[model samples]
Target: MNNTLTNGLGLLSLVANTGRAHGVTELANMAELPKSHVHRLLQSLVEARYLEKDHQSRYSISVGALRLGRELLRNIPVRRMALPEMMQLVGEVKAALSLAAPFGHEAISIAHITPDGNLRGSMESLGSVLSAHASASGKLFLAYLPEDEVGEVLAQLDYSGGGPNAHRNAESLKAELPQIRARGYSINNLESGANMNSFAVPIHNQDGKVFAALGASAQANELSLKRIAELAPILLESVQRIESTIKEENP
Candidate 1:
């Protein structure tokens, strides 16, 4: 373990999370590090362009961090390949779209897009979690995991949240996996959020294993189950394009 790197990152995170600048002495007090040590670490970060020091001798996250973030987003093949198609889908369907992949027992959104002026079903809120048993994308991801892994992930899930239609336990949700697979999509009908109906389809890798889930969400009145059925072909076509793009770029 490189203690220097770890401590530097810890301090950088503390400053970045606060969304403001901090002087070395203030950061040292906050991080419980020696003032001189904090100054040295901050100087190193500034040299690396990860932090910028102003005339006030306070440091804040800099353009280098933004560069790294942009690079990270570009390098995520699924998110990169899916974004253009997601944008097109948003134009056609006029709904919010999200790309989610399974992470532990939850489905975390890697990308989110919403039509202009609507925030009801947008999944852009930081730190929002999709419960594995209830969300459309979560259920689609779970439906494709191996049997043993599914059981393990299900055991770790928290079924206490979600709407009145959500499954109360693993057994109930587990029983629905086969149907989700057979139908080629998953639906969250007031299960993850009240008055919101979200639908998702699996995005498979070159080897045909599900890699992520592409989802759409909107107020139930706007995206009724009937409308979802009408939109299925379009969504699947987008998935096909994304998968083809991935194979071409990565192959």
Candidate 2:
């Protein structure tokens, strides 16, 4: 790529990484570019709708960037192909179901289904992000990843508020991954939230590669580990269905 485009993207990355609005001077300093050059690039991004400038001259990523992200996600076949099976699984299990994928240092929920009931607690939204060390889906992703990669991802997490039962360090978490792999699933027992338990199984793609995680969550009293284990067959069945659908659609 040309320097102009490269520098423009560099500036954009600086702003995005900050996760907040930034002024021209601030961006220039962080990117080590001249203020005038940064201003020109920022204006170009604003005109392209990639970034938006406020009245105070601060800039932040705009809706267009989110639109681009959504467009990319829309091209992924798993979410679309898995929705029906996920919904059916939710009905069979009578709990909240979620489809999540490893995103950056965390797990991002792609789709969610909650059975119609009064027993529902706070459910994770479709786009919600969860700590990889605390949530069942996250743990499943971590379990399947290389240990070094897992350590890199875990290094980015803040464990202070993870929960009472959360793994305190990478060493402790590494010790438990074998059990997860042995069972071909992961469990969360009040690790993410109080009295909340979840179970997750890996969903594979056409190449028989783990692509995403399918999980079910409910109140701890309603779903114990044994109950989750019993439900595992149903969940794995749904995962197989989803995998088949993905292969059919993708191939």
Candidate 3:
């Protein structure tokens, strides 16, 4: 192996985020790596489940990559502390409970509690890439990623259409993000769905940087917007408990 290999970790990261569905050649161009080298590197990354190669030879990152990151906090106390409270809240709110933690440029779901009594939110999978532009947890995590990553996410969010409910006004959402940063919550509607609403609040680290988002989703009918407002305090309180437990264990 060349000691100064051009095919390395940095190139892998580049391929993972260059808008998905890329072949090794295109990835190499973006990564400034050579074709043969990048192709072999991607094969290795794919074997390790850090990347996935489609039947068409297009490549993107795998959920297993996020799973590896999640394992770092396998003992995360917040998840345990929040689970029961999330369960209880889902019962009370008759909605779905969702948690998202930072996964590079995306917020990957670390935990979720679904209501069991014949009620469900649209989301059922544990590892789907919920839209940062349309999903509550996605938008919430978008605000907490790195500065440049946040800019990229926001720019992408711009194309989601200015409709009636979620992020109806681009200027307004931009103005609100600062407020969200100040207050520690991200709330919006994609406005694409007429009968759905979601609310998300950030879970802060001891350093006060947001590392996760606690979210609840429901039909606009079963859980009215006013009801969500009433439920915000309790949802936030659960988040506090979750964070406090994590800090106590780690710090």
Best by TM-score: 2
TM-score, cand. 3 vs. native: 0.66
Across residues 1-251, which tens digit of lDDT does each residue of candidate 1 receive? Answer: 69998999999889877889988889999999999999999999999999999999999999787776567566878987887788778889888888888776778877878776232332244225688888998898888889888888888888999987999998999999999999999999999878889999999898889988888889989999999998877899999999999889768
By lDDT, the better pick of 2 and 3 is 2
Q: Please report how far candidate 3 places residue 8 from its true position, in Å.
A: 6.3
Error of 1 at 146 (Å): 0.5
Global CA lDDT of candidate 3, please?
0.67
- Superposed Cα deviation of residue 239, candidate 1 (Å): 0.7
Which of the numbered candidates is closest to the native, going by highest lDDT?
1
Off by over 4 Å in 2: 1-21, 25-38, 117-124, 147-158
Clashes of each: 0, 0, 4
Candidate-wise lDDT, in order: 0.85, 0.82, 0.67
Each prediction's RMSD to truth:
5.0, 4.0, 5.6
Superposed Cα deviation of residue 207, candidate 3 (Å): 2.6
C-alpha TM-score for every candidate: 0.72, 0.80, 0.66
Cα deviation at 233, candidate 2, in Å, is 1.7
Which pairs clash in the backbone of model 1?
Answer: none
